[model samples]
Target: MGEWDLRRLRVLRAVDECGTVTGAAERLRLSPSAVSQQVSALARQLGAPMLEPYGRRVRLTPAARLVLRHAELVFGQLERAEAELAGYLHGEAGEVRVGAFATAIAGLLVPAIARLRESAPRLAVRVVEAEAAGAYGLLAAGEVDLALSLAVQPGGGDPRFVQSVLLSDPLDVALPPGHPLAGAPGLRLADLAAEPWIYGAAGPWREITLAACADAGFVPERAHTAADWTAILAMVGAGLGVALVPRLASARRGGGAVVRALPADLPTRRVVAAVRTGTQGTPPLRRVLDALAEVAATVQPD
Candidate 1:
């Protein structure tokens, strides 16, 4: 086979995904004829048929499937090469932008950036305050190099990004200082079944709270819905209702709220750092990721 054109391979992959040259053209923002030309050229170069007519659509031939299986690996390797070359060209002097929630900014990114300043003086780190649910969008759009999020579960995540768990932040119950269970030991989620709850109006935290409550055999009567930790803790402190506060946010418990750990088996918010797939190996990104992991290791609930 002659030297394969990466562009043609990409076109073929798009056709395989879309199942039609017109669909692939729309996806690739090219004319259908151009899409067909690319795939045809690729097939000619490889001396095999790449696609076959299937009713009104098209399907990949056995040869095309075999080629795609290798093409995917080649594409991934090229991405890695580009990332590594960028790192090499920039040395250790490039900037790394990170998007994270407020608490993670205070608890993780801040400390990580501080460490990087000492260890990699030329590498600048920028932070954007983004919630977990929306952070991935920023990452996908290339607005951020790293995104600290809670939405990516262990063993399951978007294939387009590489996710690494920074820490599992346990959720503790926060109550008013004078609440009956303020100093209680051996507390469990079931024990709070009757108490009014304060949780996020929507988002992963809200889902987690509801799911944990349901697993405890009852639904919480939500007396207040607040997304900010400060507001939630404030409500708890005022005896309005109890709230499930993650350890990462416990540092700002403020006055009148008492935080207590629940049973060891309770759910924990998994804080993960995600980078664009194949970019994690770059020196600047690797350094920053290491710094984040180091900071996360020492993070303790206050």
Candidate 2:
């Protein structure tokens, strides 16, 4: 229709890939209003609404879906062009996509990304936030070039993929500030048995936390479940219930919560990089792992 319409298509593509206008705004670093306006502009250009309602989510109209496919092709071409340019300037080209857990984002990935930006300036990276199992699934599905995941202690391990230990951290119990245990020097496993617990979302996490409690001599009574580390910590801060969290998650939380070691007798969770056994072995992938190594080195205890 017009030049503005073309820009709108890019907005549409961003929204579709990001899953929400809010998500698109974050990626583009644009205001939510800007994102919404672009999508609406595209509808005007098409002379009809291209996004229809489907329950609470928006469903792409047929025309919009067709446009989306073309957007993907355009994106692929853009990637190739960038790669070609990089290859012309250097010996390698391409981008790496990575996924990691919330705790790792704070404890590990931020510094890694910063180092990668400074040292491997030529490499392009896309970071996705997800849990351990999801990170592995992304690795298997080729949705990510690298996955930073947690190795649940003593569980057999993933047979189909390759793993390299990135680092390990102990898990601890978080109690709300001013709680009776907040002022205690240390707490034992049995001490936590009767406390209402905050279990990490149902997955290997549930098993790991439960197993730690079991090692302490009693199974913790579950009071709630949450996937979001912030929410879990916030709840703990509020004194809704106590939670067992990795040390990293406990770092940023200050809402009257006290963290205590879960005894020296238990196993710690090891975070690692899982790369699918075989892939292109691209430069972008290697750069990411190298950056991660740099990040790990800084945090490892001497």
Best by TM-score: 1
Ten contiguous residues with the weakest lDDT in model 1: 151-160
lDDT of each: 0.86, 0.74
TM-score between candidate 2 and the true structure: 0.65
Model 2, residue 1: displacement in angstroms? 39
In candidate 1, list every pair of residues with a backbone clash.
none
The true-versus-predicted C-alpha distance at residue 149 of model 1, in Å, is 0.4
Whole-structure CA lDDT of model 2 = 0.74
Q: In candidate 2, residue 95 scores what lDDT?
A: 74
Tens-digit lDDT track of model 2 for 1-302: 76545467777877777777788889888999998888887887767776777666666788889877887787789888987877634524457788888777777878877876676666677889887767887777878878887776221265656678887767777888888777676566677678888876577688878777777778778888887777778888898898877765656766667777755554467788877666425556766777787787777632
Off by over 4 Å in 1: 1-91, 152-155, 300-302
Query: Could you give candidate 1's per-residue lDDT for residues 1-302 as a string of tens digits?
Result: 76878899999999989999999999999999999999888888999999999999999999999999999999999998887666545545688899999999999999888887877777889999987778888999999998998854322457889988889888888988888888877788888899999988777788888887887889999999899988888888889999988888867887579998886547677888999889988878888899999999999443
**Candidate 1 vs. true structure, TM-score:** 0.68
TM-scores, all candidates, are 0.68, 0.65
Instruction: Look at candidate 1 and tell me the lDDT of residue 218.
Output: 90
Any runs in candidate 2 off by more than 4 Å, and if so which? 1-92, 153-159, 280-282
